[model samples]
Target: MEWIKLIGILIILVGFIFKFDTIAVVIIAAFTTALVSGISITEFFTLLGEAFVKNRIVTIFLLTLPMIGISERFGLRQQAVILIEKMKGLTTGRFITLYALIRQLAGLFGIRLSAQPQFVRPIVNPMAQAAANARYGKISEADEEIIKAKSAANENFANFFAQNTFAASAGVLLISGTLTSLGYEVQATSIVLVALIIAGISFVLIAIDNFLFDLKMDRKYGKKSSKGGQKS
Candidate 1:
């Protein structure tokens, strides 16, 4: 029975090697592990239900796939390019930094709009790329990939660090509950206060990183622009 537990790991390895659907493979592997550990099938369903309730927002995010597809099919990226081209003062770096600021502020207020794939990838990334293209003409494939990564990173840093600043946030509640269970007697207020300070520091650091990365891109573009001028 004990050795049978390893079968779940083997299943995952095989599934990955064969390039199977990752979500299906992982869920099946989890169920197999629970059953091998002597958990009843009914208990497994109960666990799944509880997890779904706790993270139903993520489920909703997944459901937005069709909506994203429809929007993109209707020239979502083209609209972003047009809008970004009209904004003279908004460079790629400034745009990402501004988004980070808004994301952190929204998280503090419990609004939580820092979704990368849904919001960033579809909308924000295209706009940032447009801004870069406006300034640099046409960038290399590698530079565009790096800019997208930086945009995603800014979203992640803002969302993760700022959400904890809310006293009644799920993260604070979970932390308080865990500490209570461990007999630590931690207060939610304390967690929120510390989280607030951390959020401030994170915003500053990420802003700096965005600024520096933008400078690097600027230098690259500057070189390209000078070379083009010399050729003309």
Candidate 2:
């Protein structure tokens, strides 16, 4: 019986690895495991119901999908582009870097900052493109796409790396709890201070990376202009 349950779990893992529908895999695994364990269908369903009740927050967020979809249908991208175009003297890298900083700051307060359809697809991507065009006179299609991807990645990295700095952050709390459970006296503030030091280092590294990339692009553009002038 235990072996059957283990086999059911293995099947679910395999299904996931093969990119099968997650819901179907979960349902199949649950049914198979219940059958092997001699659990009646009604009891299995009751257990599932209890699990769902325990995770009601997840269901509430899933319910918000339709409202978010409706809002996206109403000129969200166009509005973002227009707003970005109004800002002068912004470069793609600078614009994205500023957003990254804002995202990190917001994470400290446990605000959920989404990238797709909210930050990246709607705002940051368009803003980065507009900034690129403003700086380079005319950005190519490929460069515009690159800017969008970079902006999204920047937001992800910034938010993930900075959250560790907050004393009450989920990661810090999780670590502190684990240590306490293991009979070790750990301070959340000490963990947070260490996380802050690491976050600061990460910020500096990201900034330096952006700066170097911008410098390289400027040099490449300067070379191209010089060549064009020589030809003229």
Candidate 3:
């Protein structure tokens, strides 16, 4: 039975690596392992149901996907582009960097700036596309998609990594809980202060990266303009 459980975990990892649908892979793996371990199909399904009920948060988020899909289909991207274009002096990297900071600030108040259909697809993506177009004159569809993905990743890294700095953050509570469980007394404030230092360093690094990217883009645009002047 233990071997069956191990096999199920292995199958799940392999399925993830092979890019299979996660829910399908997990369900199939669970049922197969249960059968191999001499558990009846009815028992296996009951276990699955119990697990689902225990993790109802995951289920609720899954159910929200359809509403998100509907919103995205209703010209959300177009609206974001229009909103961004009206803002003066916005560059793609700068725009995303600002969003990163805002997301981190929002996290301080326990508000999650989610990526999916919430902020990324509907808001940040189109804003990024508009910025790309403003900076480069035109952007390819592939490049637009890349910008959207990069913007989302920036938000995730910034918000998640930065929020650990707050002493009362969920990360602090988690760390404190784990330490207590393991018979170690740790101060949440100390952990949070160290996390703040780490987050500060990360912010500096991201800022430098954005600055370099902007410099490169400026050089590219300058060379293109110089060549165009020669042609004229």
Query: Estimated TM-score per prediction?
Result: 0.75, 0.80, 0.74
Deviation (Å) of 140 in candidate 1 = 1.4
For model 1 the local lDDT of residue 215 reads: 81
Model 1, 22-96: lDDT tens per residue? 989988998999899898999998998899899887777666788888999999989988999888756788999
What RMSD, rounded to one decimal, does every model reach? 4.7, 4.1, 4.6
Instruction: Output the better candidate (1/2) by lDDT.
Output: 1
**Model 2: per-residue Cα lDDT over 123-173, one tens digit each:** 688777766554555646776677767887887788888887777878989
Pairs that collide in candidate 2 are none
Error of 3 at 228 (Å): 15
Assess candidate 3 and give its lDDT.
0.74
Q: What's the lDDT for candidate 1? A: 0.85
- What tens-digit string does per-residue lDDT give for candidate 3 at 1-232? 3665567888898999999999899888888788888899999889988998998876666655787777778977777888887776677778877877777667656675456557776778788878766556665677667676777788777876777777787888999889989999999888887877777777677667666766665555432232223111
Residue range with the least summed lDDT across 10 consecutive positions in model 3: 223-232
Residue 230 miss distance in model 1 (angstroms)? 9.1
Error of 3 at 60 (Å): 2.7
Off by over 4 Å in 1: 1-58, 223-232
